[model samples]
Target: MQHLEDRFNKRFGYPWVFLNEEEFDESFKTAVKGQTSAPVSFGLIPRDHWFQPEWIDEERATQGRMEMKAANIIYADNVPYRNMCRFNSGFFFKHPLLQPYRYYWRVEPDIQYFCDVTDDPFDYLRDNKKTYGFTISFYEWEKTIPTLWATVKEFMNLHPEYIAAENAMNYLSDNGGETYNLCHFWSNFEIADMDFWRGEAYTKFFEFLDSKGGFYYERWGDAPVHSIAAALFIPKDELHFFRDIGYRHEPFQHCPRGEDWMRGRCSCNSYDTLDYAPQSCISRYEKMFH
Candidate 1:
């Protein structure tokens, strides 16, 4: 991450970083790390465990929570980490310090990039009311996500108080509790409005989900967790498409300039980019050879 930041700064000039202690590794701190680049500061959210360890979740949740609580100490002391994880990384606060910054671009280390970004994405968000933005999209992991749906349903059931809320409850539910079509997003790289996150709806939503303990048991990835929550909590119109920055999404490739992003790419041929439109889901899902 440090090497990437150094190179990123040299290229982009003090890019903003939402980072954590884990990124504080020797390689990371060496370059124009956090403070080196003015507003390019790091959020430094606390991370309990990397979620890479021994023992099944059922046996280790208690230990995990303890570690997470210890990490939260930094926030309690008024210190904050730019990087945040939903589970043990307890930095899901009310967006206190983020007000000054008009935009937030999520940063994760070690990902592939194929094309250069010609347009300025941050300016796009700042100029327009694009409260939510992402590059890739996919369905939920049914096994791991069943609990998430259940948790969301239970939250709505118990808080019938928020049934009338304008932001979240609506987007998360169209056919009652059957689906979450609006929950699709590529959170590995999210650049959004901080004001939208600091709202009461999102604030309480995170807290409600946080209390559920699934972040420990089900092993929720912050990317998907945040995606679902943001989908539920943020308005759809504020969402946007950056059809130019090239990004690698695990098994898929994203290219804004590729003829695909210009229209839609779902070709099995990895040689060509995949499609973003759902109409291509059929032929594209048939084979994985590409």
Candidate 2:
């Protein structure tokens, strides 16, 4: 919290909304509130939105977990993690406390912001008519989403009218929607318009995916879900890559090069920037506009 306050929130004074499955203790609230003068809100995830739907087959889900565990998949044995993924994928935007806000900047703990933000990203998104903006892109774990692409293809075939004519399909699919090439924008560092997710197109898309039971039967992540929606429902130009904001999350870091680094007081080495790493899809994302 202190790191974030010192980096950007202190200057912007934007309110912080924190959501958890359980009530936050007083100490947690005090620590967060003390970091910045910005209003801090703690929201509890509604029971219905954070639990497995009644229609899901518990036995099948158990078997799926066992299979994934045997295969050494990450978080395969964690039920709450799966629930968190499902909630973020389909229900987070619908929370009552978030309804009044038109734009949201998703931030996670332990992530670093190397740059001092000079302008409000929300203004950039609104003035430029952008629906989705992100700092990093990567290929999804194929093992984790074996059936997701097939499900998406079915949705596209059933609702062709919902797709944009100038979508970023090339960035997602190589065989013309026959299969998912696994590329997706990492959702952890997103600043997006909530109206896009609240719209009929995205709502119906989420409903369709939810009905298929992938959230429990398979591990469907919010990153891939949001990425597919942005790539298909929004125009190519409306999706932005926030290259100026130097950011890092765990294994990867995006350090701005040259002037951006010097002006931002960034301490990271430009050569270590993962923007051009083989595992990243940033180069492909750049080709879409460049």
Candidate 3:
């Protein structure tokens, strides 16, 4: 919170809205409030929005967890993590406190902002007519989402009207939506227009994915879920790659290159940027432009 406030929010004065499954403690509220002069709001996620739906079979879900655990996938046995993924994928934009806002920059704890943000990102997104903005892109774990692509293809066949004419399908699949290549814009750092998600195409997409029970059965993450939807339902131009933002979340970091690095007085080493890594999908995302 302080990193964002010091680097960006202090300049734009955008309000911060934090949501959790339970009420935040007084100290937590005080600490966050002390970080910025901008308005701060805390929202408790509704029970239905944050838990495994009753229709999901616990036995089948447990078996799925066991299979993933045997394969040694990270967070394979963690139920809350799956719940959080589902919530972020479908419900975060619907929270009452967030309703008044059209644009949102989603921030997670322990993320580092290495540069000073001089421009208003929300205004930039609004003015440019961008729907979703992201700093990082990468491949997801195939072990976690075995059936997701098939399910998505099924959704596409059932509702062809929702698919955009000039979409980012190539970024998602090499064989024309026959399979997923696993590339996704890492969603932990997102600057986007919530109205896009609230729109009919995404609403139906999320509902279809949720009805499949993949969140509980196979750990379908919000990163890929949001990325796929944005790639399929909107023009590729609507997805903005925030290459200028210097940011880091643990193992992966996006360090602005050349002029942006010097201009922002960014603290991260440009040579260490994740865009250079073999696992990075940034090259594929960039291919859309050329």
Candidate number with greatest TM-score: 3
Q: Per-prediction TM-score, please? A: 0.65, 0.98, 0.99
- Looking at model 2, the pairs that clash are none
- Which runs in model 3 stand beyond 4 Å of their true positions? none
Residues 50-94, candidate 2, lDDT per residue (tens digit)?
A: 988888999999988898889999988788988988898888999
Q: Rate the local accuracy (lDDT) of all candidates.
A: 0.51, 0.89, 0.93
Candidate 3 structure lDDT: 0.93
**Residues 36-151, candidate 1, lDDT per residue (tens digit)?**
45445445433442232233454555554454456552222111121234522234333334546667666566666554343466778777866777766655444444477777
Ranking by lDDT: 3, 2, 1
Positional deviation of 258 in candidate 1, in angstroms? 5.4
Summarize candidate 3's per-residue lDDT along 1-290 as a digit string, tens digits: 88888888888888889899999999999988888999989999999999889999999999999999999999998999999999999999999999999999999989999998898888888899999999999899999999999999999999999999989999998888888999999999999999989999999999999999999899899999999999999999999988889999988999998999888889989988989599999888888889
RMSD of each: 9.0, 1.0, 0.7
TM-score of decoy 3:
0.99
Q: Against the correct fold, how does model 2 do in TM-score?
A: 0.98
